[model samples]
Target: MTQDPVSIEPLCLDEGHALGEFYPLKQQAQAEDFPADPAACRKDFLGQILHPRPGNSVLAWGARMGGRPVGLCAVGVPEAGRRWTADVVHFVVHPDVRRTGIGSRLLATATGHLAGLGVQKMTAFTSGPADGAGAGDAFAEATGAARILRYQRLSLRIGPTRLATDGDTGAGCELLHWRDDVPAEYRAAFAAMSSRLAAEEAARSGSDQVPEDFDEDKVQELYAVLRAWGYRTYLTAVRHRETGLLVGYSALGMADSHQRHASQWDTIVLPSHRGRGLGVVLKRANLSWTVEHEPELATVTTWNAIGNPAMLHVNESFGFRLDQSGARREWTL
Candidate 1:
């Protein structure tokens, strides 16, 4: 018996709506533990596809059956740096169509598209244990990809004293926190710290990640997009009082309407200021701020590299438990 051949095609702004529609169906079929709101997910997909920020390009491919999308594979390439690498954002296939070779076709086509752009390396992340019988693990194994790094997604239940801790001040430094926007006075220093951390992270991970292109204008632009997408950002930082430099930083991001979950993003302390317990202080401040402003916020999720014990220790103190785990897989061509 012969089955219909899967048709994989590139998607652009014209098929953006189709990609949005396929996402919810795919999530519902695959991710049973954490179901996504179709409307919200669709809205976010459309927003990113139709009006992406500058210096970012998307390459998306859809698997079609009977003229309807049944699978999706998408990746993004930064315009400014790391032109040789692509970030695989989503790779999903409808449940009913599993083990039917559709995913392989979609992946092949997506990779072909990336190859046309001269991309030399590809990176992907999925949510499951490496040894587990998860779809992501299966896909990685079948594709000859190597799991380079392991990470854990931890969730902290927000309650009285959930994220509160005593303030530990460093010599000649003070802490500052803000919501929604980075203050003008500290934007430059903030960008510098963030850029260094990004570059260092790439080096440690053995990826060709170029330095982060962060500036005051870039920070402002990010805040604008967050506002447009209905997200509130809380930022905490420690600055040297004498030098007026940002030595440590952390952030919490919560959706405006979805008050149940917040994401903890980008915590870093400068190498020169590493021993001051600044990581814990910055994280605590941001978590406290999120709880105060978003009263309905129940759980905050943060991702940590398995090798980073310092940050992990701080998160443990805040009572964050492992909610999900995954391995970062990369392939070089």
Candidate 2:
């Protein structure tokens, strides 16, 4: 007997409860058994609906089979620079009905919303092959999307031991720390170094990431979003003693809802100051602090492009192990 096809409908903040039933799909789609924090998920969803990334708007839709929600698609359109790109951040369907057209239906609906918003390019990510075939890899193949680049997700367990104790800031370098926002005096230099780091990262991985023109105002805007969403950010910045300029920085962020998990966001050092071991110093300082302040934190996850060996070496030295890998994929509208 043939069954009826799933119906796709737009989802709003008020109807987000219906999408909660499919939360298990998150673990199924990823290679690792990520800790399930329903509270965190709900908080994040509501926050994005209310206050999206500094300059971005989101569109979400749910798929229903026999009048019951079974899948979801979420797309974010940039209101600022990367205007042409729409990120399909989350797309998941229950395993039982995965190949039964639910995913395709949800994807079509997501792309439709992006098209209506004048989005020219679409970007999405899928977990790398776990077993013989990972869900993300299969889905991309089925949808004719191009696999762009692969990144390694590494994690380190926080134990009672300090990984790196040598905090020596070699010749002309000094270390500074921040909790939420870059200080007034360091904003300009931080933004310049950050922008340069972003451009270099994008070029190394062949990604379509646009180098942001960060200024004091832009930095403030991002900090505002983090505060509104209940995120706590810990940062380590290295300043040049002679020039009184910031040459490198690293950031670790954790959300109140997900206390057990922390993300190692960005670690960047200016080209001229690269060989002085600033990356190691920044990472060590932040890790030491995180282990002290965030006792509940058991895991720190970080991603590095396959082409980035220097950072990979730093992470490996800190006992970080490869948990899973992911591929960035894209489609042209």
Candidate 3:
């Protein structure tokens, strides 16, 4: 018997039911390496689809065989700089449908749409070894994309203990802690510091991509999206006491009080503030705050580029263990 023809359709906010159908395929795709929390995963999936970050747009497509969703792909285009690039946010094909043309067709459709928008390149992330023969790795290679970077996922088990609070954070720097919003007095400096971090990362990666200039409005938009997904942001920043400028910051995010897992977001220290052990100070302070606030939290996970040894050392000192490996692949259009 001949197999039924697969159909690719656009997934939009109005089609919530159809979008939800992709959850099963998502679960199956990640089952081997990353067992997901059903409730949290579904909530996060729907939340991202329903409420995207401000100044960004997402395009999703679903593949159906005889009216059942068998494959899914979603791409994101930023509103500001880097308009020539796009991110392949999520891409998966059901196991039963392996080797079928569905995956390729879905990608082609996405690329065609993006090409029309004048996007010159696209990037994707795969959750496996860059050299391994996993399905995700194989697919990326088959698509002629280069594995540009590799990252290690680390997790730290939390306990009922208080982390050390005192540390050398430079001669005249003071630490500030806050939940959810940046205080009014620090908003402008915080935005500038974030923008600087973005530029440094892009330059370090040898990419000419332009960084987004963040402001008060952009920060609020980020918080709004996090709130829509039922997440709380915990931040720890170091301010130069005499200069009254933010020199470093670290942030952690929790989905809700009920979830036992949280994720470390970002940790950045200004170039001038390096070699003072500020990274350790910022991370320890933030983790202490996270543990104190969330009594049920068990594990906190983070991802670091394999090249960043300094941050890795800090995480290792905190007892974080390796969980898995992943790679980022980029394709030029």
Candidate 4:
């Protein structure tokens, strides 16, 4: 018997909301504890594009298994990260639609557009830690993409009490930390910093990673989207006394933005300023802002490579405990 073909089209605002339904389902199926509200799904989807770090476009697509939306895949190519490479930002299909080729179809559409944009390669990330089978292994295996690195997500509890920031001074050194917006001037700086990130990523690389190689203009687009998301929350930077360069910077915001619990988005320090501990300084400043301003914040989470001890130490000082309790398996293509 012949089955109807799945239609495909470029994503637009109204149509894209369809992708929201898949969020909780994917979460539930993967973790068994995902929340039931579809509204949370919409908030997360809209937030990614609207604020803090908007990077890619999406699609509203699915198949009719007896005439219902049963699959969804969002292919996003960040405007700047990983250069022109595209990424499988989100991909999930109803278990009922599992064998119908819906996943592949979505992959094809997303990759095609990205390739058109001059993206040479594509990278994807999805993980699972299901009951001791190497968490993300199942999904990673299904996709056929090789798993190069597995990032561990961790969190630090911000105690109910306030912390100190009196030690820091804003003399010639401007501590540019603001969440609601990124200074218009930093948009250009972010792009430069983004372009420069390619080399920086290369220096730390031990596995294949995308977005790590993003360029400057892509960074600018991301900043624009982040500003829209009300995530313009944690953009912190330190300037040089003589050169006035944005020598070190950190971006902090929430992952589940509606959840109020903050998380580290991105942070970097110029090789020129590495010895100065500005990376920690930049991050600490942001944490101070969060604890001082948002008392409702519960936990602030971040992930770091197991091998990256320097940062792990900084997180420890701030009380971020290793999320040894949580892990995810990954699938890549």
The candidate scoring highest on lDDT is 3
- Tell me the tens digit of each residue's lDDT in model 4 across 1-333: 775556654445463355454555565544432222112334555554323244455434444444445555555555655445455545566654466777667766666666666676666655433233332255456656555445556677666442565225245566777665556666566656665655554445444443344445556566556555545366777877666677766777654444556768667766766655666677777777766667677677676655556677767766776553222222222
Reference-based TM-score of each model: 0.88, 0.87, 0.90, 0.73
Q: Which stretches of candidate 1 lie over 4 Å from their true place?
A: 1-5, 14-16, 33-40, 80-82, 129-133, 163-166, 208-213
Q: lDDT score, residue 277, model 2?
A: 73
lDDT of each: 0.74, 0.74, 0.79, 0.56
Local error of candidate 1 at residue 239 (angstroms) = 1.9
Error of 2 at 33 (Å): 5.9
Span of 10 residues, lowest total lDDT, candidate 1: 33-42
3 or 4, greater by TM-score? 3
Which candidate ranks first by TM-score, i.e. highest? Answer: 3
lDDT of candidate 2 over 1-333, digit per residue (tens): 776667888877455455555555554543242333223344454555556665787778878788766787877788854578787756777666767888888887777767777787788877653234467677887788877777788887777665447377887788887888888788888878777767766687565656556777777887778777678898889888888888889998887577788889889988888877778888888877776677788878888777789999988987888877777778767
Off by over 4 Å in 2: 1-5, 14-40, 80-82, 129-133, 163-166, 207-209
Output the TM-score of candidate 4. 0.73
Q: Answer with 2 or 3, whichever has the higher TM-score.
A: 3
Question: Sorted by lDDT, highest first, which candidate order results?
Answer: 3, 1, 2, 4
The global Cα lDDT (0 to 1) of model 3 is 0.79
Query: All candidates: CA RMSD in angstroms?
Result: 2.9, 3.0, 2.6, 5.2
RMSD of 1: 2.9
